[model samples]
Target: MQVDSKAIDKFLVELLTEVGTRLREDSIKKMSVATKKNRNDLVTNFDKKTEQFINGEIKQAYPDATIVSEEGYGDLVKDMSGLVFFVDPIDGTMNFVKRGDNFASMIAAYIDGEPLNGAIIDVMDNEIYHGGKEIGLFINDRKIDNPKNLPLVEGLVDVSAPMALANKFAVQDVIKKSSGFRVYGSAGIIFGHLLTGKEVMYMSYLAPWDLAAGRVMCEAAGMSVVSIDDAPINMLESQVVIVGTQKVVSEALKTLKTR
Candidate 1:
């Protein structure tokens, strides 16, 4: 069964907006604590519930679509040849648990191993970034323009601070050359930066759920998303993420020693 990109995009935007609003309402009702998967890793009840809710909806809408999601609400997706949905109930679990403002809900639909449509909802801000192959991207109901070409030293950049501490892939040098660096900890919000051209680039270590929606949306907006080495992203594996304008991406690649 072929999936319609427009239908998928609309469904994801609605689902993300609905669930993200619920998360905010849930937070206002009480102060929720998070459980630790490790020292810095965290999860909350809302995260699990949100994924389950979205997953249930996907099952009803597209029963054959494989789900690869965070928080264990999805199946183990080993193959990427068919239709699949990548869901991240909460992209910044720690930020949601600690700061409660930087997290987001994200979804991406893939057909025949290609990204078809995606949505990223900034739960705290009530902003939705929705895009698909057939139609362009929209923030809320307004269409967004493609970012102008900018040099690495002239635009903002978002990167994970932890990666700098560990010098993972030597991105520190890239940070030094950039105008400035920001770390928001959520792929969805960082994706927002990419959409607006607020940050020319967003780099970090990420999982399938983390980059799924952002990948499709970024590409739709005439941006590029790839690993440090400029390889095709592996949807089933963990990898370094770099999304930016073309120039920023080209310059950032200079600092990637891993390639």
Candidate 2:
């Protein structure tokens, strides 16, 4: 069967919108939360429900497609060789549970290890960052202009709080080269900033669901998305993500430690 990427994108847009609305309503009704594997790793009822909703929709849209999601509502797929919807029902679960902001619902569609489409819903603010191979990116229905091809010293960089401070992977060197660094817990939000060119680069210890959507979108926009080692990220695993303009990426990679 021919993959209808457009139809899938449309379905995901509507689905994420509905999920965001429901999450907001749930938040207003009551304050409910749960802890995941650790205290920092939080999960709300809304998270599970939203994942369920999105998972069911994706199954309906492409029954053969495998889903690897943040919540328990997906499979333990070992590869991305076929159609797959990598989902993060709540990208910033800690924020959602504590601050009630900075959270997002993210989805990435990949076929045969190639990214087809991606959508990240800024649930708190109701903005959708959407993109695909054929259609470019949009911030809530408005097409975003292309970001500048900035070098390392000329632009903002998005980094995780831990990665930034631990000076892990010689990240301190990147900070010294860049104008500054900003840490947003949610990968989806960082992705939004990257696509808009508000920052020169974004890096983190990203999981499959965390990196999937942003990887494809940034690549489609003539930007770069790769691991700290300047290698393509594996969709089935977690790794260090580095995204930026071509030049900035080149500079940052030079500072990164390859394992």
Candidate 3:
């Protein structure tokens, strides 16, 4: 189905808003938290419930679409063919478990690897960034303009804390070239900032669920989202990616030390 139209946008916004409501209410309740991948990688009861909720909703609405999701409640699809959905129930789980804030819920649809529409909810703020290359982007209902093509020196960059500290990919070099550096711990929030010109560039290792919705919104806003190693982005794999203005992306690619 064509998802960039007003009707489709409304459907998506309502869906995301419902998810946001659940999150807002769950934030106050005591959550069951657990570790995933490592001690620091946390997942909570709300995360699983939210993912199950989203997956069920998607199945009911678009039964044929294959879902790739952060939580395990999705299909184990190996390819991005036909209609596909990528979902991150809670984009910043650590922050959600710790601060009860600075997190988001993201969902995006793609048709044979090309973005159809993406929806990202800044849950606490009640703002949803939703749209695509054809329809542009909307913060709730406000249509936003493209960001400036800022030079690396004129803007601040957001990098993962570990990458910055370890100087992985020569990230610290790129950080020193920019106005400064930041770490938001959530790709969805960082992508929102990029669209609003709050930050210039964001670099992090991201899974498909983490990158999908943000990629759609960023590209719609005329910002560049590219792989740090100068490879074509594969939606089925995890990789270090960069999203920013064209100028900043170019500088970051040049500064990136890849063997």
Candidate 4:
């Protein structure tokens, strides 16, 4: 089937903006919450509610598109085939629940397993980082260029707490080679930073929804999104991933390759 990049980009931006507004409204209210894997891994009424909304809208707008989403509202996708959409109603659920900020809503579209476009709405920041291979990159309404292909020593790296603390993937070695270390606990927001050149690198374990929008946006902006283990990028599974400028990725991959 023929895919329309312009149509998809327009739909993604419009839908995410509508969803972001709802997320902002929900942020201030008291919502029921429950634990998943651990106490810190949470699911809220808003999370499921928002995901259902997005999935429903996607189905209505593009009936043939299969959705992969957090909160169990999506299809049971077995492979990255056909027209697919990935949705994270709240990318930083912990941040959204505990702090009422720092979270985001994300969606990305892929056609026959190739990225088409992605959009992330930082609910608090009110900025939507969007676009992909076909549309270029945009933050809300403004078009932007790629970040500098900076070396690892010149910029700070965002490391997940568990990865940094446990020295997972020998990430400490990667951090040491960089200018410094930081962690924001949110992949979408961190990816936004990477797109704008606020940071040079981000390393962490991310599920499909968490990785989808960021991966599309960052890669489209000329940044590198890769798996250090050299596995093919799979959209249906969780894995350790890295996103950064091309040069920084080369530098980081050298250290990660040792693991």
State each model's CA lDDT, in order: 0.84, 0.82, 0.87, 0.86
Instruction: Name the weakest run of 10 consecutive residues (lDDT summed) in model 3.
Output: 33-42
Candidate 4: residue 188 Cα off by (Å): 0.5
Give the TM-score comparing model 3 with the true structure, all chains together.
Answer: 0.93
Q: What's the lDDT of the predicted structure labeled candidate 4? A: 0.86
lDDT of 1: 0.84
lDDT of 4 by residue, 161-192 (tens): 98899998788989999888988888988988
Q: What is the C-alpha lDDT profile of model 3 across 86-186, one tens digit per residue?
A: 98999988787777788999999888889778899988888999988877788998998888889999998999888889999888989999999888898
Q: For candidate 1, which ten residues in a row score worst on lDDT?
A: 33-42
Better of 1 and 4 by TM-score: 4
The residue-by-residue lDDT of candidate 2 on 1-259, one tens digit each, is: 3677777778778888888898777655445434444433334566777889889988987888999998789988987777988999888777776777888889989988888899998888999888787777778778887788988989989888888888888888888889987877888888888888888898888899998888878888888887876666788888988888999988988888766
What residue pairs clash in candidate 2, if any at all? none
- Give the CA lDDT, 0 to 100, for residue 54 in model 1: 95
Give the count of colliding residue pairs in each prediction.
0, 0, 0, 0
